[model samples]
Target: MGRIKKKGEAGNAKNFITRTKAVKKLQISLPDFRKLCIWKGIFPREPRSRKRVSKSATSSTTFYYTKDIQYLLHEPLLRKFREQKVLEKKISRALGRGDVTDASRLERNAAQPEKTGKPRYTLDHVIRERYPTFVDALRDLDDCLSMLFLFANLPSTTTVPAKMIARCERLCFEFQHYIIVSRSLRKSFLSIKGIYYQANIQGEDVLWLVPYKFNQRVVGDIDFRIMGTFVEFYMTLLGFVNFRLYSSVGLRYPPKFDKAKDDEAAELGAFKLEGNNALAASSQAPAQVTGGADAETGPDPQTQAQVNKLIRQMREADVEGDEAEVEAGEEETAVDAIDKFEPVAPGGDVLPQPSYSGEETESLFANFTFYLSRETPRQPLEFILRAFGCKRIGWDAVLGGGAYTTDERDPSITHQIVDRPVIQAASQKEDGGDEGETSQQLASNQRMPGRIYVQPQWIWDSINDGELKRPDLYAPGAQLPPHLSPFVQNTQGAYDPTMPLEQQQPEGEGLEDSDEELGEGEEADDSLAVKRIEGAAEGMDLARSDDEEGGDGDNGSFGGFSDDDNAAGEDDADESEDEALAAELQYQRELEAELTGKPVKRDTASPQSKAKVEARKRLAKQAKEEAEELERAKGMLSKKKRKLFEQMQYSNNKKSAEDQKLRAKRRKLEKQKTRAKA
Candidate 1:
């Protein structure tokens, strides 16, 4: 026979451990345990049966897998945490004994370990252990980049230090340098909250948003400590990723950073890169060594993975010689090759391709030089131009010093992006003021000769359309066209303002165009209907009182008295409608006789007019055709899918109605303008 198992010794009890127990097992404080879990990529676990795992389990109780807790025992960061705890105790003891100087000294030494000859811990191993491959890191870099960029723009608060903000900004610039060099940027969008960007790096698509350059308001709701923890980890991760990317292209990592240019907010211009010969003995060198340079070079993704492998080897070699911090058994870290997630091609025949002799859209702006007005956003314009193969871009002197030319009259400029309004030489404002002329024109804004002046939106619209848009439409002070979002895909049957009206309008609305156009006034011709509604309301009140009073059905006269009062009410309504129709017909006949200057003869027995009969029949035919089409479509869908399709039809019809209303308003305004001119 086998030995009997004890309670809380096997199965669920053995597998699951509570948060308190995990913290105890790791021999660290709760905060330290949280940090460790975050760095090691460990999360809370839920057991199938809480009662089986722990007899006292409750909804608030947090649990973790026993194996994960056990694995945390070998983490090198645990030693640093324990060391910090001891240092804290030493500082507290000194303060309690009134040795304030000693306590302050301990704190300063711990804070500045380099100056004090004390070794500080870096999360190098944790970064490698968490993400074994560079692509793995890149896949998760979306959140990292967004958070870092946001904090980089935020003001320094008591919660978030200035140094942290500076470092975040520096890292973000470094990452953008890599993006520019690689030319991996695929798309950009201008959104109200921020600008969004999508890039394809190493066949993996990454999308992230950057806040507009407005003063960031750090609200009270955010927990800076938690975000700071994440920022710390991401900083290390991105550094390593940058190193791998730079090494892949045989370019030096950390390139050259110019403090003077950075101080002046020269941004992307502050960093310069060189070939591999610029490398020092190790990768831990400072960023200030290299000088400033332009972003004219980048790395190839084909060799990124290979470079990561080499870096991993170097990391492993460096860790192997460390002074007895981690145990021999714990030193075994098997960082496997990248786990690829390639998209499978659909099984279908290949289609023919269209060839063109025109320049590719990637180089559409390559031949032209652009000069931006002072009012235009220099950074976004510069980035877009550089990404799309435009080499020489100039801006105002106040903006920065890195432009190709600060002079607006630069002869080489082919395009000038201006956001200012038109100036009429001040004549319209001064001389024509007494004549009620609106001073809507600028006084002195002249355009340079041989340069096409367009609004800032022209650049974005041209890039999105994959061709240069007509310059006349986007000219300054030319009632610029609506700047549509590039990210919103145009769907079939949806109302898009950019598309022709006749193409996407609903069938029913298009048919009613004649009636809509012929309508003379906005007021409704409902005089008879209003009288009938008043009469109906008087009868409805009397009926409601009768029902409340429990009166017998004695009011209906002339063989109409019955127990059912609803049928009598319906008959009364029919009689009232027929009387209203008779009154309308009599009025129409009188009007016709007055217009023709002849007596109007009544023909009660005559059939409906031929036009009316044909119109009714034609409407019936159209409705029948529509019903048949709907049936055919419905036959191909399941009941649930049919309901969803009907919902989409309702939404599309509503949107089409709105678009038609807008179009009608515009037509009315245009007619008013024409009448005023006449």
Candidate 2:
């Protein structure tokens, strides 16, 4: 028998701790403990078997990992909490003694850490510990960015201070500036709930949602305190992430923020990005020096000599007809030049150099100028478009200022993004009836020739696809395709709606054979029908020609015969022709039956055949009536309403097709997984 185990020493009892116990062990209040856990990435844990962990049967107990609680013991912020508790005790004791001056002094001393030579506690170390690498931090950035952006847009309330809101807004703007400068923003979508933005940072796609400006309604259902705590943690996390991202591209972190400009709502333009000259010089100096010396010193002597030698060798090799040797010599000379160049500054830090290939850094939208309609969200659209390299962006005057050109009829505008429904009314003529009127007088739906008009989603689709989509697909009043999530990865055996059915199938091996068989069967049936019809026609033609020949012979042989004899002769000939035709058709049917392996049957008309045919006609007539009724119902709707209904039907059909494709893909994956397991 095994030795008896002590109480609370068996199973998960030793591995898990209750929240109450954890708070007491940390010597902090519940709120403080919660804040610390959030900052340090510690979360509540559930035991596999509650009975094994707890002696009593209580369902309301919240458990955490024992090791996580133990790890929290070493956190630097824990000491700060203890120091605050001590200070509070000191102030309370002074107040109890009626020493107001001592109490005030104690409070001032506790608040001013600078005078005490003790710096404020920071989450920098925790940030490093939580995210071991920059990519890890980026992977977790979606939640951080989403939380911060949400708080930034929230109205300041009693629970949420104005200062916190301002800080969140500032941090968000600074982050947006980096994205704009780097052109990492990929896609954005305007939804009924809020605006969704996706950016590719360090190859990790980060998507966050920002609410529409001045549209967030604070509700009582949400606990602002909890949200505020989360916002606090994310604020620190995003700051570190921004620093790493900026420094990676040779730009200074914490870009200069202008309070005045920010207060004026300048957005991204308010911040100034400073370059890290030391880093840039270190990375580019080698390439510059290798190509040639600085303009002040001219080309280096040794490099010039090598270049001349390479040229001479190339000429000599060309004369000798050895092109390979000449190419090899040129490559060798280029490599030698690169190798000989050294860094000018000794003992300098060798930072990771950033790749600056022009092709890799090509702008997503380099050629087109866009105009935004009044109904569209101008601010988000402008920022996203400009970030992607659309320089000339115009908008309606009603959307406010800072536009490249407010004139909607600017002939140079290549693409216009309008969210409003298409207007069917023609342009109204003025009293003068002049052809050359101002652009504003033109009808709302009148499209400019040679320019493409699209919905707002066209820009997002183009950016996400990394190329221009067909303009007609996203044109105003056209039924738009289902917008799929970019985050979803297409796995093997997944059916993509964008791909054709033939490609989705497995090489069409069996399907091709079946289709060929069907085609051959159809062709055989058609050939048989055509041969039978031609045979019937030929038999009739032969009978007619024989009758005419016989009549001519009779007329010559018996010229004096009466008309009755002639009629009798014609009847007999007709009977003989009928018999011959019947025999020929019977023989043909027999032959066909032999070849097809089927029994031949006599052709006899049945009484029920007519009734069956009539029933089929009645059903077809009913179907036609129902279709006509639907058509009449549709005709009752106005033109605009009819168009909208058609659009709705088309959208529904598209959605159904997309859903079917996704279901097929899911089933295929499940089947494959099952087979693999088996």
What TM-score quantifies how close candidate 1 is to the native fold? 0.68
Every candidate's lDDT? 0.72, 0.72
Per-candidate clashes, comma-separated? 1, 0
Q: Which ten residues in a row have the lowest lDDT in candidate 2?
A: 284-293
Error of 2 at 24 (Å): 1.8
Show where candidate 1 strays beyond 4 Å.
1-7, 112-119, 277-359, 423-444, 479-489, 510-678
Candidate 1 residue pairs that clash: 423-442
> For model 2, how does the per-residue alpha-carbon lDDT over 162-203 read when each residue is reduced to its tens digit?
777887888998788677767778767667767888888878
